[model samples]
Target: MARLSDQILTAIFSLQRHLLEGINETAATELAIFEQFGETEITIPALEQLQNARQRLTDPCSRL
Candidate 1:
C-alpha cells in the first residue's frame, strides 16, 4: 500500500512541479483537473504522500 502510494505521489508531484514551472491557460486547466481528480479520487493516504513530495521538491533546501 505504501509503495503504491509513493508511486502515485511521485507522479503527481512531478505534474505539480510542471504546473509551477509556468502558468498559462493549459496549465491552469490541467491544474484544475489535478485538483478535482486528486480531491475526489485520490486516497487520503496518497494525498498526504503527494503533499510531502511536493514540499520536498519545491523546498529550496532540496535544491542544494
Candidate 2:
C-alpha cells in the first residue's frame, strides 16, 4: 500500500510538471509573436485568450 501511494504521488507530480512545461511553451510562443508584431486588432483578442488560458493553467482550482 505504501509503495502504491508513493507511485501515485510520483505520477501526479510528473503530470503537473508536464502541464507547467506546456503552459510555459505556449506563453513563450505567444509572447514572441506579440513582441514581433506589437498589437493589432486581431492580436488584442488573441492576447486576451492567452491571458485566460494562462490563468486557468496556473490556477485550475480557482475556476471551480
Candidate 3:
C-alpha cells in the first residue's frame, strides 16, 4: 500500500486534474475535503491556467 502522504498527494492530484478538466462541481467538494482534512489555509485554487506551457521551443545548439 502507498504511504499516507502519497495517498494524500494522489488524491490532491486527482482533484486538480478534475479541476483542470473543467469539472466545476469538484471545486467546492475539493475545498470542503481540504477543510475537513485540516487544510483550512488552502483557499487558493488547486490549479491555474498558465500564460503558456512553453513560450517557444528553441534548438539548444541554435543559441551557440
Q: What is the TM-score of each candidate against the true structure?
A: 0.32, 0.73, 0.29
Q: Mind sharing the TM-score for model 1?
A: 0.32
How much is 49 displaced in model 1, in angstroms? 0.2
How well is each residue in 1-64 modelled by candidate 1, as lDDT tens digits? 3356788879777876665553343445445656777655555555555566556545643443
- Angstrom error of the Cα, residue 25, model 2: value is 1.6
Tell me the alpha-carbon RMSD of every candidate.
14.1, 3.6, 16.4
Writing each residue's lDDT as its tens digit, candidate 2 over 1-64 gives 3455888879777778866876787698679879988789978888778878777777853332
TM-score winner, 2 or 3: 2
Clashing pairs in 2: none
Candidate 3 to native Cα RMSD, angstroms: 16.4
- At residue 8, candidate 2 shows an lDDT of 86
**Candidate 2 residue 44 C-alpha distance from true site, Å:** 0.9
Rank candidates, lDDT, best first. 2, 1, 3
Q: What is the C-alpha local distance difference test score of each model?
A: 0.56, 0.76, 0.43
Leading candidate by TM-score: 2
Better of 1 and 2 by TM-score: 2
Q: In model 3, which regions exceed 4 Å deviation? A: 1-4, 23-64
